[model samples]
Target: MSNLAILPILLPFLAGVLVAFFHKNLIASRIFSIIATVIHLALTIFIFMSVQESGTYVLEVGGWEAPFGIVIVADPLSALLTMTTAVVATAAVIYAPKSLSRIQEEFYFYSFFFLLIAGVNGAFLTGDLFNLFVFFEVLLMASYGLIVLGNGKAQLRESLKYILINLFSSMLFVTTISFLYSVIGTVNMAQAAERVGEVEQQGVLTVIGILLFFVFATKAAVFPLYYWLPSSYTVPNAVVSALFGALLTKVGVYSILRTFTLIFNYEVDLTHTLFIYLAMFTMIFGVIGALSTNNVKLIIAYNVIPAVGFMLMGIGIFTETSIAGSIYYLVHDMIIKAVLFLLIGAVTYAAGTSDLKKMGGLIHHYPVLGWMFFLSTLVLAGIPPFSGFIGKLLLLQGGLNQEEILIVIVALISSLGILFSMIRIFIGGFWGEADIMDLPKQKPSLAAMTWPVGILLSLSILLGVGAEMFYPAVSSIAEYVMDPELYIESVLKE
Candidate 1:
């Protein structure tokens, strides 16, 4: 079981190497990528089941002792995240051939895609802080390649901005790790958590904590640091945008969750207060951006920025229920966001434009695509019987439990904003007079592209309807995360 933890990371890395060398054939590359994703998904499920039966599993890598060599750990939180990453990556791979340019299909797209998966898997599974940083860079490097792969002027310009911002953040990340190492004398997250309280200077720890928060905030597209996301993500192809929309910021959020729960719990009250305010502001700002944007993709991009705030709000509330809500919402947002982006991508492919102002009456011609878009948009807006509704209810319940009146009000406002923006897209893009003449005579392959999206939408519905099962799972994860002594003991013990 301990050995199984490594497969998710290793499989993608190995597959990437093979694809980079020998699988230049698009068919072979696609098959290999799909096979790799399927195996990773299966391994993730097995890991989740193992955790369900026996609790968290810990493996000291290379048979070396923990706190000296690297370790891989799979608590419920890590397992759930790994599973989510695998599912999303698989869906993206399955959907890509239909969406990617023929050049991209033949070149480095599959290789880089698998590398991105490996990086995400590494980030989730690593029990060491420095290892997390390494994985983050790996993901970023691959993203840089993908963003610039098409070589359009817009792609080049936006990719440069994205690369520069991320590079700066990477530098800050290195500084934070150096300071953490200087203070704790170890990069092992479990050890850091154990010793963080005993560090000589509380001020230093606080400063480091804030710096690290900023680093993640930038990566996660939080308020004041999110300006680059919409513009940059808009430059990529729909398939790339959909994958990034689903996974990238979630990785940052995941890092923040892990770091806060494990390493920076020394000043919970302060961190909680700060994150709460940030969450409120992020949600407000992101919704406003969505409201003002005319481009459908940009609206989705802006919406992604604020969703982080909602998740962070749960983390800030810090009750058992809030933490559980945050976990559930994290998974929920990942799927819904991906589905929406893919739908938008399909819409753009059909219309040759992303501007809602230029699109109209698609429902009359492309009923399947229109309804898919409508359903996904509704789900994203937190309509009932959808995953978003369940997540929002849990988060709102947590806010009420804490008597956080301001947060409750802000959350309500955000929901309204989401609904309005979604309505704007639906009414303008799908419900007006038929503008089918401007669109391509030949539609993209709906069956190939739509099925993966259908799978994601189904999962979202299943998560919402099967809340009885999921809530217990989330609660168990929250409990494990909040108390992590068992994780520490398992990893460090002889």
Candidate 2:
């Protein structure tokens, strides 16, 4: 079990190397990428089950001990997220060959894709803060390659902005890590957690905590810091865009969860209160952006910001039920965002533009695509009988329990705006008369593209239907995350 913690990160790194050798053969590269992700997914499942049965698993690199040498830790939270990353990455690879241009496939697309996945897995499973920063760099570098894969003017321009913003965030992350290490003399998160509890200069620690919060919040695309996201995301092709929309920002939120729940938790009263307010602004601003955009990709991209806010709200509420709801929502959003981005990509592919005004009555020919878009929109809006509903309900219950009436109200109203924003896209892009006479008719392969969307949507539904069974597991993850002693013991013990 301890050894398995390294497989998720190692498989992808090795696969990336193997795929780089076959980059000229798109078919071989695609096949290799898919197989690698499938194996990673299987490994992640085994890790998840192992963590469930045994509590946590830690792998000390080179047999070096914790608080000194590198370690990989797979607690329930990391295991769940690693499994989700594998699932999403598998779908992206399966969808890639069809969505990517031939040049992209022939180049280093698959190589960088696996590199990105490896970095994400490493970020989730690493036990030390400095290594987490290292993984972030790995993923960000790979994303730089993937974002500008085709080298179009729009892709290059937007990719520059994405790169610059992340570069700045990376600098901030390093600075925060330095400050933290200077204070505690350790980068291992569990050890840092132990030292934080014993540190007497909590006022300085509180400032460091706030700085760390800002660093992670930037990656998560929280308000003010999120200006780079919608534009950066909308410029990429749907496959890359969908993958970023689904996974990247969530890693930031996951980092926030790890930091606030473990190392920097000495000042939750001060720190969590800030999260609650920022979450309110994040949701409101995100909805406003969605309401203002008629571009299908931009609307979907903007929605990702608010979903981050919702998860943060759960974190800020800081209850087991609320955190569990956030974890469940995180899983649901990964599937839903992928579906929405892919579906929108198909629409724009058919219509030859992302502008909703240029697209009309797509359902007349592609009824399956239209309905998938419609239902996924509702699932995103937290409609009843969908997975979003249960997660939102638990978050709201947590807010009410904490007497955060205003936060609850903001969340409720934001749901209305979310529904409105998505419905507008549906009516304009799918329901109106076909105005696409001048556009070229090179539609993407429906069977190829739509099947992946269908698979993701099915997962979304299953998350809702199976919530009764899954909730307990996420609840346990929440409990484990909130109390870091179990993680410390598991990682530090000889």
Candidate 3:
């Protein structure tokens, strides 16, 4: 059992609570939040390195043991995601002080922000499915307050929709857990996987698998279930958007990735095949929404959906290269999406409107911002020499190797659509008639906004150009997914 494993979750919670006491002191609150996030990132990096050395670290809370008690498993997959969460959270926390209104700041914004990070970290580490549900609520409850911080009408309406959908999904999540526990007599994920493999009634487990997919799909906001995401995310300020865009939905994607690869692999022919097709349609529809939008925020929001499908396309393919590709894409997307939202936040801040038609000549005023958004567009669309390209190439190769021609063709076409939709913003916002509107009265200092965006975008470029450096880690993560025995043995045997 490792004490270090718990710190990613616990340290943030403690920092958040301490920040709450600084409600009357903004300087202290911001300083503490930034420090805590930086520390969390450093710790997760250290934990990730240790996990790389030993394969996995299983920590049983309160000296409890195995399936009988709470467990936190920091395998390569979870460790990688936890590290990414910390990095993204650090960016959001750094970006917040300049972006958030004084009223929003005076309230418990920093506390809520760190709480959200803690919840995300806990979700990544928890070995128990029930504890996973608890972490979900923790993050969602914190998000509800963050969403309504500006107290705007649009924020209230959209956040209510966001909350109700999550509540429904949470209820469904609990019911699924209860049913699974009744069947296996355990909610510990590693134990459940072991029991699931031994159970003869593959039919009921398939139903459970499908039900679990439905629940996570709702949160990941794939296709038909994705309507709430664009609207809800669009209402929040850029920092909140960056955080949610970078981390939240990835948790749902992570859960789906974890469960299917671990607990529900017995009926892959049925379950995975269904997931593959849904992922295909999700990409198609998501790109369509991006093309249909004039609002840059909605366009960015819709773009989030298509990438979700792409990441899962790798998972649904369930091959080594495919899974590795998805993991890379997941980490890459987190950084790039944060970069995108931060850029758009800068975009809307300078333009005074999210409507692309009302924006023009941005390239003249902010040449670096325009070029960054333009390159990010290329990255998002999987262009060569960019991060998205490597993952998309692997995914396409996997699909073709599996002779999933329809998915391959759909993925290629969707990339083109994604490219056009993003370029629409560049062309409309940066290249056209210089039809700029009055900038926002409360615009932030350019350096404050661009620093986070530039750093994240540099990381995205490094991710692509330096893909070889990440090859071993992503490959091992793929192995863990392909062989749950590695995960189960590490947890129970330890």
Candidate 4:
């Protein structure tokens, strides 16, 4: 069963390679991509369930020992995220055939999509830090192909900015990894942790930890560094935007969460405190960007930053409950963000524009889209009895328990800011007069596009409504992440 770990990464890469040659038979390509995604989702679910039952499973390549061979570890956290990634990718694929431009469809869009997802799963499951860097490159190259499929002025411009920044980060990442290897003698994460404990995290190692975090933060779209994301994501089509918005940045955050908790925490007083302040500012600046935007895509893109901050809030507090809350929140945001972007696509399809000022009274014509968009705002804002609430409650509780009063207040205010920013979209886009000029001449098949939105929405509802059922598992994941020794021991086979 442990051997099944490679399939999630390998299956998609093979499917993508196979699909690449089917350029002429688009109908055949769609079928193949859909089948591939469905299987990927199933594989991830099986791995998730197996990990829940069996604890972590580490697969070392080439039958070599840990620290000497490359290893893939399907721990509780990675398994859950990979499962969630598959779920989101499946929905994106289902919604894509009719939604993308003809040029995008004519090219190997789904092929690049598969490659990106394979890289994402590899990032989550790899136990080696250098392999993590390799996986980042894999996903990024795939994303570049996806972005350039647009070939429009905006897409080209934004994609250039997006690429340049990631390239800079990648260079810095390799340099930092080289420095880390020199000091620690291995890039196997477990070995790095073991060696860090032996040397005690101080002086040059602390510099390496912060430098490494800086690289991940850039990828995660933490503030100051996040200026690139809103513009870059907004320029892509809805499905691409949804995938980038919902999952890519989360990978960066996942890297941060894994590293800070596992290998970079000896100076918590300095490090975690920096996390709190940065998170606080991230939430503030992110919502400001969201509220100021009238472009529907821009609003959604900016909101992604605040969600990143919210997850970091849980991490900065560094409590078991807070970590649990962050994980729950992270999962919830991934689904809701996907739902929101898919709806953005539907809305623009019906309205023929992304500007909210030119849009009006969509509910009168498209009740399902309007209503779902409205409900999604509630979920995004963490209103009661929905998916976003429980994780937020736990985070807030954890903050108060630690007597971190100021940051907690900022988080609360930021939550309200988020609700207000999203409601503006609902009110402006769905509630006004039906402007005849704004409606598309040929009304889109809202039904075709929205089924994916509906599937993800139901999952979001389940997550919130079933929070108690999920509590024990989430807590265990929190425990698993908080203990560096467990990760080190399992990966080292000690």
Candidate 5:
């Protein structure tokens, strides 16, 4: 169990170093990454099984006691996220060869990829707040390299903006940590949770909380801080974009969830209300952007902002069911969004453009891709019998239980907006008229791309159909997150 707790992080770090040293040999680097990710996945599975049997596990790094030495903690929530990270990383790795150019491949892309995985795993498992900040830097530095690997005009322009925005956020993150450490006198998350209330700095804590919020909100692409996302992300290859799409913003969301639930519950009434308003605005603005965009990738990127809003709404409502629904929706959105982005990439690869007006009659030639996109669209729209539907159902029920009528209305309206924008894509991009004589012909080899999309789609379907099983797991996670004592006691004994 102890090994399970650490291997998810260790395997990737070791592999990343090995890949970086052997960067000149692409084949060997790829093989090392693949093996490392597979091992990481196995470790996550083992940890999941252990958690299922024992509830949670804690590992004191270097065999030192907690509150003094570093610790890694795995409860249901972190374990589940770790598992999701593994699955998405595996799929992105598979999709990379087709998406990355040979020049990009020579730049140690695989090493950075594994390092990103390692960072995410560390973020999910670490029991220390300072370690979380370290992991965020690790991931951000790797992402910066990946985004600029091509060094094209577009890549450089976007990378500069990306680095600037993320740098500001990182500064805020460090400041927040400094304040937190000063207040609690410990960086261990469990100990901090235990000691935070004892501090006589309510006003300072509130200030720090707001600072932390700004840091994460930027990373999560919440409105007003979201402009950098669409342009920056569009410059990367489809695989990198898909990976960032699947995992990066969610890291911020996870931090918000962890901190708010564990260490800052005292400010819930204030913060939760603020979150509710931000969520409503975020959804409205994101959908409007999606509706206005003609670029397929940009549309998807804009839609992601609203998806985060939906999850935030669940958090703002502050109910057991609502938080559980948020968890479910997060997992659902990550898989579906990755599949959608990859599908768009495949279309761009095939048609040599992402402009909706320039694409048409794709359904006739690429029925498989069409059907996959259609199914994903339905899932995104929260259509019945899909993963999105179940999540929305739970969220709405929680809102109703809390008498948050305005939020309920806003949620439904935003969902309709998703449906409407997706329809625009379907009609104009896939099914609309195409000049058959003028369209350039190319051999369709979307088979390799289909595998990742298929895996994602299958998982979405399974989650929806197996809701009975998943709900319990989600509920358990929500309970664990809402009460930090369970986590603290496991990691730091009295």
Candidate 6:
């Protein structure tokens, strides 16, 4: 069954290639994309279940040995993330047909979409550090194509900034990987994890670790490095925006979680401490941006930073419980963010604008959109009875256990700010007088788009209400990540 690890990557890569050929036939393209996503989701679920029941599966390429050949390892963490990516990407595909323009649909949008999934899955599952870099490039190139799908001027300008930053980040990643290989003598993650502890110049190793982290932090949009996200995220159409918002940044977070725990495990005192402070500041600055934004898209985009901060908090605390909370929180944020973006997209469609000041009293007319938006805000704010609350609760508990008083306070305060910003959106966009001037004369049929939103919203509810069932799995994943000895043993064995 270890071969199943490669299926997630191969399925999407092949499907995407096939979808590219159907670009001229929009109907065929749509059907193919939807079917492809559904099949991908099913396969991902099977892989997740198989991993849980059995153990981590590592597939060595070309019959080569460990630390010498490319490998894809499907551990619990990677499997869960891949599953979440599939779900979110599937939703985006379902929503894209109606949300995206005809030209955009016909111009290989589905191809790039599946390719992005392939890259993401490959990134999640690959055991080789250089292969990880390779996967990042694959996903990023796909993103570059996806972001400019419509060929709009705003999309081009913002995508340019987005591309430039990612390009720099990629260069840094390669440099760090090169430096790491020079220091550790291998580009295999498990090998590096074992070899890093034996290196003589621990100081140099630590510096390289920090540098690599900074590269990922830029991608994850930690404070001071996050200025490009909001503007670039908002320029794309809602489907593309939602996809970017949900999956792309999480890849960075996933990398951080993987590397900090796996390869750079020796310098906990220095590296993890840096994460704590960075997480705190990231939370503060991110929510401030969220509260200050008037554009609905930008508001949501800004919040992604703070959410990243919250996950970083768990990592900083660096306990099994804390790591568990962070994993749960990461998954929760991915789902809820997708829900929020799609909900906001629906409102944008109805109003023909994302400006909060120019829109009002949407609930009186489009009550479905209003209520869904309101509930999703609560989820985003970590209100009770939602998945967000469970994640927040666990993270808070983890922080308290670690005696991180300042971050706990910062997180609590940031939660309030998040609530305030989201409430502001609710009040400004969904309440008060119905402003028909800004709204579309012919309200678009939200029937198709709403299905995906509703599915995600329900899933968010399930994650919260069924937290007990999930706690064991999340706890197991955390344990595995924090202690990668078994992981390394499995990957290196014949």
lDDT of 3 by residue, 1-494 (tens): 38888889899999989999978789988888888889899999999999888768888888888989899888889899999888888888788887888989989998898899889989999999999999999999888988898999999999999999999999999999999988889999989999999984387878987888899999898766888899998999888988888888999999999999989988878888988988998999999999998999999999999999998899888898899889989999999899899889988887878998888888877788889999899888988888999999888988889889898899999999999999999999998555355655554457888888777888888888888888787888887788989989988884
Candidate 1, clashing residue pairs?
Answer: none
**Model 2 clash tally, residue pairs:** 0
Name model 1 segments beyond 4 Å from true.
199-201
- Per-candidate Cα lDDT values, in order, are 0.86, 0.89, 0.88, 0.91, 0.85, 0.89
**How many backbone overlaps does candidate 5 show?**
0
- The top-ranked prediction according to TM-score is 4
* Model 2 Cα lDDT, one tens digit per residue, 1-494: 48989999899999999989878987777777888888888989988998899878889999898878999998899999999988888888888888878988887988888899999999999999999999999999999999999999998999988999899989998998898888888899888889898873388888888888888898999987999999999988899998899989999999998888887776778889999999999999999999997899999999999999999999999988889888988988988888888888888887778887777888877889999888898899999889999899999999999999999999999999999999999899778676544644664457788887888898888888888888889888888887878888888883
Write one digit per residue (lDDT tens) for candidate 1, span 175-274.
9999988877999988887788566238788888889999998999877888889998888988899878888999999998888877787787788789
Question: Candidate 2 lDDT (Cα, whole model)?
Answer: 0.89
* Candidate 4 lDDT trough over 10 residues, lowest sum: 435-444
Compared with the true structure, what per-residue lDDT tens digits does model 5 show for residues 1-494?
56578888888888888888878787876777777777777878888878978877888888899989999888888899988888888777877777888889879899889888889888888888889889999999999989998889999998999999999989888888998887768888888777765662377787887788888899999877888988887778988888888899998888888877787777777888788888888899999999998998888888889998988888888888889888999899888888888888988887778888778888777788888888899999899888999999988998999998998999999999999998888887678555532455666588888887788788888888888888888888887777778877888776
Q: Report clashes for each candidate as comma-separated counts.
A: 0, 0, 0, 0, 0, 1
In candidate 6 the C-alpha lDDT for residue 271 amounts to 91
TM-score of each: 0.97, 0.98, 0.98, 0.99, 0.96, 0.98
Name the regions of candidate 2 deviating beyond 4 angstroms: 435-444
lDDT of 6 by residue, 222-324 (tens): 8779999999989888888888899889999999999889888788888999999999999999998998879999999999999999999898889999999
- In angstroms, the error of model 4 at 236 is 0.8
Clashing pairs in model 4, backbone N/Cα/C closer than 3 A? none
